[model samples]
Target chain A: DAGVTQSPTHLIKTRGQQVTLRCSPKSGHDTVSWYQQALGQGPQFIFQYYEEEERQRGNFPDRFSGHQFPNYSSELNVNALLLGDSALYLCASSLEAGLTSTDTQYFGPGTRLTVL
Target chain B: AQSVAQPEDQVNVAEGNPLTVKCTYSVSGNPYLFWYVQYPNRGLQFLLKYITGDNLVKGSYGFEAEFNKSQTSFHLKKPSALVSDSALYFCAVRPHGGYSNYQLIWGAGTKLIIKP
Candidate 1:
């Protein structure tokens, strides 16, 4: 089965602009979670979508939002992007919303966003 | 609040030698710990997880993690290191017995480099 896939492997944006990243969850998976990975840091949780509804969110501000389609694909939209937003945006997929401790998450290749 | 700490920024080891990446986490209730590996410019890959039962959890790519409840630590280990194993390692944790509402808190990541 094909793993999680993300679109626009690389993107360049300017300050105050907007950008959108896309993700297709792994086959048979229904939950999608977005994460931001800055250089030399681990991925940080942005938010999660299940059943076409946002189930949880991290400390990110309102500028960052996401959508999950019925097909389990997801899109992460960022408004008023900043230089700090230049990082690898990762998408992870799991089988369900409430995962057991042993449930492993599969991640996409991620979209590298460069803000000028 | 949940948090994870990767004590080392980088770890250097010789091929054929055992390797260990240390991680500690803090969260309310039982802890759901996970380890993921990331190659350069790629998304994170699932390594292993510790929910309950065995303290030593084996996962993909010959990786294993020992969950120490008393110490609140989950350290990734391999019997022998390989140059191919060199990559960024992350530790994450979420509260147990909770819905997907709890986000997975991640560490700063540890870079492992194995020399020939």
Candidate 2:
């Protein structure tokens, strides 16, 4: 009954650098989503992965990409990181029953990213 | 565009007092509303959600939300606040039915400070 888990509790990078954050979704979940939360702000949606393909994405630029493995784990990759990209990267998992199903998403302890 | 609003930036209350954090949403049709809490340096934790059924939905940590359809509001409530309840609370929304989009529109978040 393990919940969603994320790797590298914290990370530090510089401008023009790239980083990858990992996420293992909750047991019995298949869909994974990424979000960014700045200090004192709510989370902003990054993108969602279902069936090993990116299903929907938010307003984020192309520098942000992700991969969902067959085992339902996910990895978020950010290239050419900027100071603005320094924030808490959150990973959430949900079960996609259907187009109309309202599945509650469970989140993992976010990975804090600091772009130096 | 579908959006969620948490009007208050912060709220302060003494322990043992009742508390409320407001959330409003704008969506084309019925909305799936959710409430999540985040402690300092932690990720978001699901509190409660409103899909269908009763207007009064209870969730973790003595939290309950009343879904008002006419008002398009889902306000989180607690009978008695505790010092440990101090944290940042977020409200999120997704348009219900007729769509495969699982993206959740998030609010700016409200900080709650429960003084002992």
Candidate 3:
């Protein structure tokens, strides 16, 4: 089966503009989570969606939002993008909402966002 | 709050030599530890996880990680390094049990380089 997939492999946006990145979770997965990875840094969790509702969120500001579709696909939206927003946006999928300690996450190729 | 730290910014090793990437974590209660690797322009790929059971956990791509509860450390190791294995490695942790959300706390990442 196909792994998690993300759209807009590369995107360029100007400051003050908004952008939306899409993701299709792995087959048979339901929960979707978004992460942002800046240059030379590990990914920071943005938020997680389950059952078409946001289940958990990280320390990110209100500008970063996400939605989960019925098909378990997800979209990450960032408003008023800044130069700091330039990073690799990754999407991960898990089998369930309340993950056990052993639950593993599968990731997508990610979308590279460049804020110009 | 949960957090992870990859002490080394980068590690260099020769091909055919063993390699190790160090990681330490801080979390309330028991921690679920994970290791992920990211190639250039790609998302993070899950390598291994430590929930309970054995301290030494083997994972994909011939990677293995040792979980040390007393030291709060989980170090990734490979028997023999290859040039193709060069990439950014991340360590993450999440609290186990008792109202713990499955949100992961990530480190800044460590870059591993294998020379021919």
Candidate 4:
């Protein structure tokens, strides 16, 4: 079965521009989440989508948002980007099975966004 | 404060030696812990997870982690290191309850380098 997949492996944008990154979850997974990994740091949670709606969010600003399609695919959009937004964006998908505690997330290759 | 902590920024070992990456976490309820590895420019890959049952959870790529609830730690380990195993390792945790119950809290990550 296919694992999680992401598009636009790399992109460059100037500050204040908007960008959209996409992700397709692994086969049989129903939940999608986004993360940002700055250089030399672990990923920071962005937000998560379940049943076509955002179920949870992290400390990110309002400029960051996401959507989950019925197919379980997802998109992460960042508006008015800043230089600090330059980082690797990762997508993870899990089965929102019976309970949230048992969910295990699988990650995708990620999109590297460079803000100038 | 970062809920998860990876005290070592990097670790170096001979290819044939055993390897260990330390992680500790603090959560309000029962903790769900995970480990992932990232190769250059690639997305983080899931290694293992400990939700319940066995304290030692085996995952992909011959990696395993021991969950110590008393110590609030989940440390990744391998019987022997390989040159191919060199990569960045991350530890993440999710508490059982809260506003965002299923969101993962991550560490800063630890780089592992194995010399042949």
Rank order (by lDDT, best first):
2, 4, 3, 1
> Please, what is the TM-score per model?
0.96, 0.97, 0.96, 0.95
Task: Encode model 4's per-residue lDDT on A1-116: one tens digit a residue.
Answer: 99999999999999999999999999999999999999988888899898999988888999999888989899999999999999999999999863454878999999999999
lDDT of 3 by residue, B18-95 (tens): 999999988878878889998887788899988889999999999999998899899999999999999999999877
Residues A55-113 of candidate 2 have per-residue lDDT tens digits of 99999999999999999999999999999999999999999876687899999999999
Evaluate every candidate with DockQ and list the scores.
0.72, 0.82, 0.75, 0.75
Candidate 1 displacement at residue A8 in angstroms:
0.7
> Largest DockQ belongs to which candidate?
2
Docking class of 4: medium
The residue pairs that clash in candidate 1, if any, are none
lDDT of 4: 0.90
Candidate with best lDDT = 2
Location of the lowest summed lDDT over 10 successive residues in candidate 2 chain A: A96-105
Better of 2 and 4 by lDDT: 2
In order, the interface RMSDs are: 1.9, 1.1, 1.4, 1.4
State the lDDT of candidate 4 residue by residue for B8-96, as single tens digits. 99999999999999999877678789898989978888888888898999998899999988998999999999999999999998777
Model 3 residue B51 lDDT? Answer: 82
